[model samples]
Target: MTKSKTFWAASALISLALMVFAGYSIYGRVALHFSGDTIEVKPVPLPAAEEQEEEKVDTKSALEKIKAAEKEDKEEEAKAGRGTPAKTEVPRMRAVKTAFEYKDSAAKSVLISGSFTSWKDKKMTKKDGVWKTDIYILPGTYPYHYTVDGKKKLAPGKPKAPTGDSLVTVN
Candidate 1:
């Protein structure tokens, strides 16, 4: 066999090995369960008295809530001949310490500014030359970028190109 063909075969083998190892790391060897294993589902416990009371007070069904809101809007419109729409609720913060990773680069400093972050400049500083933040947020996705030397850039804490914003996964 020619040297070129041998080199290609070696490269293919190395790629396959890397893929196999990646799969193993993601799913630990003993983590998988077969049909023989028992299901681990559990029943949810009952809500506390206070929780139940709160839920009762807010017992409007989705349709009921929509209808009530529509009614309120119509009444307001008739009274005012139309008015500005109610302001949108921004997504609240959840965890502050989010990780940024892109192709082969990582974030030096990442700050998020979306409706979630109230569009405020919450600067995420870098510790050990790695972006570290402790911001609280709610359940929602938003556009974010890293700030390097007061310049806007995408998070690069994981693996990605330095020129574009990418998804940053948190643990």
Candidate 2:
């Protein structure tokens, strides 16, 4: 009979393992007649009908609770507003990024990694020193840096981040 190589190999392996285990167990029993082993087994009783009835009855209430939770989340977000965010929250942004093209690779492409911006490579490199990249950013002040490869490099002292990797705050 013809069998696929993979199928035969898998079947043979499983049969071999079973046979070996069976042989080992038999050998252990025959050679070392006495055997003693213990395993703990416990049965946990499920909650009875009254509790189950109450639990099932509460599903609607649970759904209401979930709705209430979602409503609370929305309220909290609105109250927090775009500008007023937790120290950890970098609010979602639309503008996202700003790119520059320098003269050459004298500068490096840096990822604006921080709570304020979300993009990895926030800046771009110029063919020679030109940069062309946009920074997705929230509408607020953000502390960021110009990363050359992986290290931080101070942007030239210019008002705009694209011009001189100066620390910029988006509004």
Candidate 3:
């Protein structure tokens, strides 16, 4: 074969090998991601017939007590010269402590961004091969994702948001 032809063939083979290596690397990372996680299921016991009947009775009594309490409140308001209580402002929701975690041993840096953070990246701390961050958030549903080494990745096993991010409900 001509030297030029040999050089071209060698280049093509090298390119093919590089592509395969890249593909395998990606596959291994993905496999590690899925395989390292675990899920636990605990069986729940059904209530006894007597317990179910008692629960129904208790629920009815509780509802009746609530109605009586509301009636007393309205009567007190009327006596206080407020015929109907003025519309009270809704109480602000308290922020709840929420934890976010991700596992990626190869990542140099991990960050989290979401509606809670106004889409700003928040750096996560790494410990024992896991990345973790705790943020206080108001009770509601929010969409979020991780940025590992500057690349976006969804939370594993989480429901996808409309914008293709992971969904987290804080309460």
Q: Best candidate per TM-score, number?
A: 3
Looking at model 3, the pairs that clash are none
As a whole number from 0 to 100, the lDDT of residue 131 in candidate 1 is: 52
TM-score of each: 0.30, 0.32, 0.54
> All models: lDDT?
0.54, 0.55, 0.83
Runs of candidate 2 with Cα error greater than 4 angstroms are 1-97, 100-104, 107-110, 118-123, 158-166
Candidate 2 residue lDDT tens string, 4-59? 88889999999999999999978865443223221112234576799788987899
Clashes of 2: 25
Q: How high a TM-score does candidate 3 get? A: 0.54
Report the number of the highest-lDDT candidate. Answer: 3
Better-scoring candidate (lDDT), 1 or 3: 3
Candidate 3: stretches off by over 4 Å: 1-64, 73-92
- At residue 111, candidate 3 shows an lDDT of 96
